[model samples]
Target: MTTDLVERVRHRLAGESRGTDPIALAEAVRAEAGGALSHDAVLAAVRQARDEFVGAGPLAPLLEDDTITDVLVTAPDEVWTDGPLGLSQTTIRFPDEDAVRRLAQRLALAAGRRLDDAQPYVDGWLPARQGRIRVHAVLPPIAANGTCLSLRVLRPVTHDLAALQAHGCIDATALSILQAILKHRLAFLVTGGTGAGKTTLLSALLGAVAPTERIVCVEDAGELRPTHPQFVSLVARPANVEGAGAVELPELVRQALRMRPDRLVVGEVRGAEVCSLLNAMNTGHDGGACPLTELIRVFLQVRRVAASFPCHAFSG
Candidate 1:
């Protein structure tokens, strides 16, 4: 049913205006795709296509809005956003759950990922400005309802110390303290809740790194954009639809280590990869760093009394 709707929508869109008026297009699609699906479903399908081709579908306007920081969709008819004014709902509505599912699948595909009933959920990034638009979507059973979507707009890494201070994210004293920490090349972690400017601050500080030093970053997704003159990055990959060719964060850390970086950075310290990273840092990789948004347990199992639980036993 969805495949047929998508085909018809695509055919209709070929002749439609290039303008980004979703409502007008939705009305036209409803007229063209008469009885194809319900009225709402046809509109949803059109919006989904619009998201793929013109805007982010139902979300193009909100995403383009400079004030909005987050977009959330709980159901086809429901949309909410967080901006300078905080969380609020919009009049915009999706056609139906199927339309929502199609948008989700389209976003996942944009990030070179697959999302379907088999996968149930997807977490990826969309290439949008310096704002790293992180996409997370989930389908039924796991979702217990319609597809749920969460989009976060990450700040660009072009910010500097002055920029951070201007935004009131740090004070002069705090700036001095942070600079001292970085000047000494001390390994450290920054913690914060959602929307707390953690990534923004980190990006600015990374820009402050001495030019003579080389930096290598490993992350689940490629979100960091440090202004360092010499920097390399390795992004973790998930198994494809065939469950093959997966490159995990831990392994990427190991690869980064061999790159001879003066500083190692873990975009986020999650999973068993933490063990590999910790072992590496404990075994002379002192200048490693990560941003801890939430505390996850790190199991440091003490091995038998005889064998030392050294870096030898670990493998990313």
Candidate 2:
């Protein structure tokens, strides 16, 4: 079968220092099959092998759809995607649990993270050139139902307030309020639940900022693509398998302060970075903003405590 031929080709090319060359894969396919497969079959096998080794085997097409925001794989046969229309099941299915595991490992490896028995989970961004992709994978025992992979395809789009209104993300009154907030350079937070439009709204609002002002954003994932000439972002990095070469959010926030940013933004607040960000905002880092989703209730409580302060403590 095609899968068997792809496996043989993979073994032949294993450890070879070559990219996904069509010529190499074709030769390997012919040699593996001893000329039994026709030219068309050989081409098909080459594509399959290339996908298996270097690409997102079955999920490439799904990722290519810019409208899709999330791709979830809970089981070997269960795949789902969420987008503007909301969550929906997909027909894409892996051949087996082994195939699913292979894909999860490969994607984690592509993201420069290791996923094995020792490190059963990986949180990183997928290595891609066209757009941003955030990847998270959990292996067996932890996953409980085979390898689970979550792919967040961060679409690159410039959404202004008008565009957001057109998308029904906000109404006229809310848009006016947001415009007023930005006009006054207010420090604020956008709180919402999972799959909420926090990132989208933040990006749109940031995009509407004054062009002369510099916007520097810090995020664990590089999801914000505001259409501003002075927009610069610092994304956090996870520690490697050896537990080194990691960049945390708090450090990035401190670094951003030194960048002389006119507008300071954090994609999300999740850890000790909250202190750093609070210091930055309270110390006259005007036009500061970020979204909050994780620990929503706790963040709300923190926001309440912050609001009780004397002056300019993260006002809504």
Candidate 3:
């Protein structure tokens, strides 16, 4: 099919159709052409339109692939993905930089964020029925190139310690040490570089805790999916465009302290919440797991027998 025909159908739909239903779209396609479009053309137009209206536009198929762990967009023509085999380029390309910017803005809006020149970056999550996507997008000047979009895909599968060991994320010796840490209710921290499976290891460790113990998790984006029976999670909220009704991690940590959490888990410690979390663990919130990046200096100041595990493995 020609691009002009698709463009015509899209223009018609923009005026007539507000929904992405294939049947309605097909009817509109045929009606816009006065019943001239063939079945193949109509089907093609509907599929393309549906893709545009649905999740992640052209990147929806890649997101749906369970094997893919990360998807990156550096330019309209440069797209990369990370899977079990590792980072590799794919054939997917955007129509232009404007198309890439449009998709980024749309996704940011879906995540209840703003992505424009004034606020050129957004860190948020796109929640799905089966999995969640952590979206980090930056505009040109901040990105130092074109618009850069990074997506970290977290599927809804619980990785226990055994699963981690099986996947080579941790050896049997490391698994035993982790089990003993939980058994003794030792407060521990996991640190690593970007995409180093810190969150995955933390989730698995929390999943190993006793079912009766209450586990409360606080995160900027709700990405942790542990398979424990007793689990509670609190997610931070960004301020609206008017800069009102913002909830940060420190406040959430203070609230979690009152909830009688046997294991208070901080998904990632980045700022002021470090004080609140230290107070919690100091006062007797044993069996705590904190995952962070380049925040060990803060942990060093607090005198505690907490174990620090640096995760370097990347298992998709």
Q: Which residue segments of model 1 deviate by more than 4 Å?
A: 1-55, 296-316
Cα lDDT tens digits, model 2, 1-316, are 4567667778887756555788988888888999899989888777667767877878998998878888999997899999989889999877778888888999988888999999999988875655878889999899887889999887666788999899888899999999999999988888889767888889999999999999999998888998889999899988886889999998999999999999899888877788788778788888899898866665775676567556655665
TM-score for candidate 1, please give it.
0.78
- Tell me how far candidate 3 lies from the true structure as C-alpha RMSD in angstroms: 5.6
Q: Pairing residues by index, what is the TM-score of model 2?
A: 0.89
lDDT of each: 0.75, 0.85, 0.81
Locate the minimum summed-lDDT window of 10 residues in model 1: 297-306
lDDT value for candidate 2? 0.85
RMSD per prediction, one decimal? 5.8, 2.6, 5.6
Residue 283, candidate 3: C-alpha displacement in angstroms:
1.7
Predicted model with the maximum lDDT: 2
Give stretches of model 2 more than 4 Å off. Answer: 2-7, 294-312
For model 2 the local lDDT of residue 69 reads 81
Candidate 3: tens digits of C-alpha lDDT, residues 1-316? 3455556766776787456677877876777667777889788767766655567988887898989989999998999999999999999988678778878988999988899999999988898755888999999898887899998887865778898888888987898898899898888888888778888888888888999999999988787889999999999988876678899999999999999999899888876787788778767677888887775665563333233313311111
Assess every candidate by TM-score: 0.78, 0.89, 0.83
Sort every candidate by lDDT, greatest first: 2, 3, 1
Query: Between which residue pairs do clashes occur in model 2?
Result: none
